[model samples]
Target: MTVTTSPLLAVRALTVRYGAAQALRDVTFDLAPNSALAVLGPNGAGKSTLARALSGLVPPVAGSFALDGRDLTGQSPDTIRRAGLVHLPEGRGVFPTLTVMENLRMATACDRRGRAAAVDRAFEIFPVLRERQRQAAGTLSGGEQQMLSLARALMVDPRLVIADELSLGLAPRMVDVVFESLRRARAAGVAVIMIEQFASRALDFADRCLVLQRGRIAWSGDADRAGPELLRRYLGEATAA
Candidate 1:
């Protein structure tokens, strides 16, 4: 069945496990179309696992996922991506040996309008990419690679972009640049689900926040309502102790 509502993505009673270790337990949430949600948690909070489950990279042990009301629980990654649910995994997985242009081309290959238009769109977002078109992806700086990874995902014209740790290991200014680009994507009507370690910065770009603790939702509310005290509580002594 398909869901016809404001939510573009919905997960119900989701569970993920690695052997006997449960990474996510009864996780659930809704991402409204064109909105941004920041999934916040400390290390081992199951944030990445949840992102993977939603993106069809890791199969859920239980529960259901729907995109625009269409059930997507068991779909392959490619299939889910084709349906406009794109996942940009953590670590910015660009083909290091390939040139910037080649990486963009590889990503655009899956686009319906084909590579040409997708390349154009990618360059429009990060003009620096055009300048480094011939540079091997491995040679690009960490920030540049992050831009390329995001551009690659945008090439698919996804309605929902699931970004896992887009700001990992980047300088502060570069983090601003990446998040700014994400704001642009959201302005263009793309819903975004971001996993971020920096709570304040994540709140800057997110309308709502979900804090995961030990594979379950510890808190969920408007970003404005999620203050330091709440964050400290959810994060526990690991962050505040």
Candidate 2:
């Protein structure tokens, strides 16, 4: 039983809606520093919606989130991102027209004191990027593009990384590499909130698991304890349908 201490982010009674349909309903959770929590559920489970709201891309209909006692409600995406809360959206958000090195150089909004070292760190994490630094981003393989995305996020020196569907549509080996990078983020004492489609992998990497179904929390607890049977209980109905 690993108790999360000194929560870095707290979401309470959060709600979101898309005109007539509700996407999230009174969702609440806390993420402590140096911890990882995985969000798992079937399609249309409001996982992406939650990520969007957290990143300040979408406004919440109700509820609030705080980071280190500061309210983040209704902040702009750039504001939230600059505050050391980085959001890596589902798609690899690399600059397709730019070269690998250029893409890394573009995200210079955060602490510029260590920009050079951060670029070096990014290259170290994904050696392929260093090899293809001069290559156009769009020409790289899917896995390589994903690596660039992760590397871009790291350039910010974020305190919390909200990664949504990081391994989606990637080759199996690339998925492993992407996850290993996220594991490194955790190892560096950064909090992570991962929304992943692969339940097994997410569960294994997370310290806690949260299952969302129909815009609400269905289950949440220790990740290691959430076995197949438990996952099936929440996801089975949708899978069988």
Taking all chains together, each candidate's TM-score versus the true structure is 0.93, 0.93
- Candidate 1 stretches with Cα past 4 Å from truth are 1-5, 111-113, 236-241
Model 1 C-alpha lDDT per residue in residues 1-241, reported as the tens digit of each score:
9966668888899999999999999988998889999898889999999889888888988999999988999889888988899888889789999999999899866454688988998898889999999999999888889889988888888999988988889998888888987887887789999888777878878999999999999889998888888888887655533
Each model's lDDT: 0.88, 0.88
What lDDT score is found at residue 117 in candidate 2?
A: 90
**Off by more than 4 A, model 2:** 1-4, 109-113, 237-241
State the TM-score for model 1.
0.93
Clashing pairs in 1: 2-69, 3-69, 237-241
Residues 125-213, model 2: lDDT tens digits:
67788999999999998878887888898778788898999888999998988898898787767889999878888888999999999
Error of 2 at 196 (Å): 0.9
lDDT of 2: 0.88
